[model samples]
Target: MKYLSFTTNCVLILSFVYVVNCANILGYFFFPGKSHQFVFQPIWKELALRGHNVTVITTDPLNEDIPNLREINVADSYSVFLNHEFSNVRRESTPPYKMILFYQEVFVDIFKMQMENKEVQDLLELPKNAFDLIILESHNKMAFGWKHKFDAPVVALSSFGLPVFSHYLHGNPIHPILYPDFLSEIRECTTLVDKVESTYFTLSCWFVVKFLIGPEADALARTYFGNDMPYLDDLEKDSMVFINANPIFSDRRPKTPDVMEFSAILPIRDTLTKDLKQILDNAKEGVVYFSLGTNVRFDHVQGDVKKNIMAALGDLPYTVICKWESESIEGQPKNVHLRKWLPQQAVLAHPNVKVFITQGGLQSSEEAIINAVPLVVIPFLGDQPLNAKILKSNGMAETISPKELNRELLRDTILTVARKENYRQRAKELRDIFLDQPQSGVDKVVWWCEYVIRHKGAKHLRSPAADISLYHYFMIDVIAVFILSFYLTFKIIQLVFAIIVGLFRRKPAEAEVSRKKKKKN
Candidate 1:
């Protein structure tokens, strides 16, 4: 009886300690696209699984009842995308600078909707210091004010790579010629024209990010969170940034310690469903998977482009699986199969699965590498072009211009990747590198989240240059001081020389006068 009582007492004490150590975390993802969720959901969900009290303000909510996890659903947040067709947007191929404007307008609309959300407003009304740490998406800068309201440290997350302007958040170096913007076509900067184009893109986008987007973000932050909130730009200070791009295949650019990267954030299944398994396993001729990701709906892919793509797939001897939104395509080939939604990673993991033709979205590219499959990229817009180019350079993929795509070109490209053993071999090498990290991406994210809470923010790990002004960062003041000192020294020496010359002239004049006096005498 005595021993039983002692054991019970020890168990009670341990439980109390566990409860005390659990942190309260709040995560907000502004982008409503499901692809972004693939990178972020695993992170916040894992935190809750680890005994933390996690509450997420998200458009895509896991409506299940999980202990220690609460969902503040902002279902209407996706309304911002309903009006615009991304296929039309891609056709226009908006330049990097103009794309910023387009995104600014779209995000501003989302800001109003999210701020005006009743559940979100109710969340804000809760007691101060309610959260121990805050996780936010980088695209939504205004949400950084939540850090102030809750008095919590922030860990900024990006679904993809950061824009050139956002490099300042972690004091990462910004190089245009070598590390061009993701939206631009200038990947290799061998020519002067390439350098010129990259320079213009970097400078112009920086101006737009600071001047045009800054004021609007500030105003929105002030109105919603509080007028006392710090400037939108400054709120990124002391925050950790995690990018979804892996450094190996990404641009060979400089990175600060604060920036963390990961490729395999989403879960990959080892088994496929009954129907999918049967189809993939029986494909002796091999299999091809094609998808345009979430933004480019299949129904919108009409007229000549659709016809050519279909014609190409029809000619291929292998079985093809495509992610289609509609019930059925009109002229869909007998060899091709369409599913409204399919498990992407599991399908890619099949043995017979060969080359994947895709829109080359970041998540898609990462998945391709993670699954060890070659690619045939038909880039549409945004980072797709850049991702495609990088993959091609790595010997893991081929790039085809969307505007120039036709039956013969599409057919030949897909066949080349599938038949060429090198593409598959290179993909396997890259996949090994991506998975060679010490811990999984999800685990790394969870550890860092807890680290910030334990240390009361990652202030020590922060970049010294992150919070400083641009003039101070560039050492303009220090350079000015040196320049001024040199100028003053030069002027002083000139003055002294002038005085010495004047003294010699005076001596000569006096000597001449004395000579004249003697001669007169």
Candidate 2:
């Protein structure tokens, strides 16, 4: 009896320990951009640190030898950028659908390459029930089906703010008036016409994703996940939660509780390099930093645009540091300093760095605000225009459309923001607000991640609207019923009135005929 009691205690202790350390997470972040990768890498890093066996298939793989870390690096896809996958994004004023189609074409190729790669395929071919959770980048829908492959719960990573289609996937409310469509340039202060335009853009994007992009992704996923797996579209709706990069400071819109925003995850630099610090410390006239994020390289800019930008920077009294890819920029300004790459967050944090001339990428915009640096944004493609517009609306930045950009305008815009203390003040205010969160972005992600694991994928956190059909979700059929009933009622009333008037007119005509007949008699 004594030996039996001792054995039972040992068994109970062992079970407790196993339960405490039970999570094998697989993260797929195979999007081909540094900015997108930057947003998600930290989440996996923290998960690994917390003793979760985390494996990530990424373009930017882990460099260190961390315990419980596995990486399947497909950096070869960098050639896609070199081959100009995002070229001629806005050569003409293309509509939003065409723009999405263009990106979808590029993304589909990237997805196929990643999945067909031996390493990723090997991971998939592993025995069933391999992982406890799967985190997929929400941009490319191909890998969302990995949930079925591993028989684990899924969590989606949204690099930017959620678009209309993404909201539909997760059952987040998308009010056209309150939240403007992601692609369109409409904002909160829109008129009836603007609302109509925004709603149309939202509907069109939903259709394109459902009929066009969704099918492409579903077919690709079915190819590997087996036809027996739940459809990719269905699996996508079952995502446990969405970790979005949109902070409350960036856009003060309503959000579902299931969506967590880790906006500052990308640019959290606590220290600056010695040389960069020295340059900023010595610049009494102030400093301006310019970089078009990672996607749009400086070398790809047209010669005329480059020349004009250089000339404008040259005229600035402040020292200008630009991220230029070439060894030398022709007609480079005396005051301008060009480097192949600069530590963007460190430079933005410098006290002397006044105005950030950026491509208005969401990460860059958030970084600038976090560091209290105002912006002069030149949006080129994707959601840059929307970011610039909202930042300008918040009075923390000024915008110059690429088409409207010139040497004089660009120079003046930079100087205006640099000299104006209001932009700086507003940026500082937002920075304080952004920093006033209950916990840091890293902490929030790590906590929520563990919570999900502990709760067995946290299905209780999921919104039930995600399971409803699109027609029912939007109440399109209900609206159709109301419209049809009103139309029928209006027709019935019109017919009854016409019949009553005809009867009265016929009686008057009959009386006249009878009087004429009496006269004849």
Candidate 3:
């Protein structure tokens, strides 16, 4: 097996030759977040490599020169993300409602930008039946209209966690409290206050996404796909769903057969730089790897918080490898090495590395688990907090809130995670489970994508719940019927009892009146 190093992400040399029954696949990954693109890229890349014609419209394109692949680059749309200062949102404790509103507004602008692109406009103008299947991203409905334009089957692709409303498309069960949305901070709650808070946040987001954001997105789809386009809600009824989540760390939910969990084995160049490899090898006291992930950069951290983090790490005897995008961090210790980028998976896989200090992004979490490395999570945004909560519950990690981060707390937590054997033990046990899957690397995705195409859409696999109405889903209407029946039954019984008492009273009165008449006579 030959491995090529490209900016630290490694692609496995898949052994299977799946060139038979090649089909044309069109992928629309419109959400500008790099993390979202990460989930969908591998599937399209593999399909292209396996002799299928794969055309993708994305904000983050592969930019690879592979045969059978055509990429429409729309990376300039990433500027929409820079418009928001998420660091301020965290500090101000922005209410969940406002946060979601801001989220939709930003994404709406991105959609407008991408759809208006010359390439996307031209692609949309293509004749019907242009592609056999369409791969669509979750969270927004603007791109879902492609199914109508192309007259093809669509496989839903969810990054990290499936959106709350998308769960309905596949008929998966949803409980605001039991299974919280990824956007919500409270995944599972014990206290009444926590449960109430969870319910509010979850249901509020659910309503917003389904009613406000979804309809707006649908209208935008019409703006592009023509005014007569079918509602995205209708077009979204998919039989095959691919969620970029593995069972190891994802919240426990009963998923239908159609909703399968898979995380593409993050491909990386196998070789590490000589200097870094030597540094890791020579770390006599093990190594601590710190990174804030792409969405949350180290520099975005509060000045005090960044200082405390650096101080905490510098105090540790272990060597620290930090991923800082800037040229350098002031007052950084000699023991702490700074790099603009590191092959995260490669570094985590090192035996000498003790624990990963991360922002708890799904990709970082998956890689850490696969490498059997314990975690020190300081979550920033999106699903990081939820991922941190899951990791802590599973005993594979120690978590610290970004707001409460300090030198003593960060230092102590890292030491606790590193020194303890159970953290590593739990990681290894879960790693075994994650690694013990059939097919090598991305072959599973390639097979599923083709399976949907071969079967001409798998409506049989969709859950019955996805089709049931809200009135029927919770049996609210059925409960109303029962309540109405019981009320009527009780009212009839009360009226009958009153009539019996009235008849008895009338007979007594008639007897008294008869006595009086006899006496008078």
lDDT of each prediction vs. the true structure? 0.83, 0.80, 0.82
lDDT of 2 by residue, 270-373 (tens): 46668767778889999999999888875676657877888899989999888888747667877787888778887887789999999988788888888899
The superposed Cα distance between candidate 1 and the true structure at residue 12, in angstroms, equals 12
- Residue 221, model 3, lDDT: 82
Preferred candidate (lDDT higher): 2 or 3: 3
Q: Candidate 1: where are CA atoms >4 Å away?
A: 1-20, 88-93, 269-271, 300-303, 496-521
Write down the worst ten-residue block by lDDT for model 3: 7-16
The global Cα lDDT (0 to 1) of model 1 is 0.83
Of the pair 1 and 3, which is ahead by TM-score?
1
Pairs clashing within candidate 3: 5-269, 9-267, 9-268, 10-267, 10-268, 11-267, 171-466
| TM-score of every candidate | 0.90, 0.86, 0.89
- Write candidate 1's Cα lDDT for 226-299 as tens digits: 88888878777668887776755566667787788766546773467798888898999999998888877755
Q: List RMSD in Å for every model shown.
A: 3.1, 4.8, 7.3
Full candidate order by lDDT, most accurate first: 1, 3, 2
Output the worst ten-in-a-row residue range by lDDT, candidate 2: 242-251
Name the lDDT value of residue 372 in candidate 1.
91
- How many residue pairs clash (N, CA or C atoms closer than 3 angstroms) in each of the candidate models, in the order given? 0, 0, 7
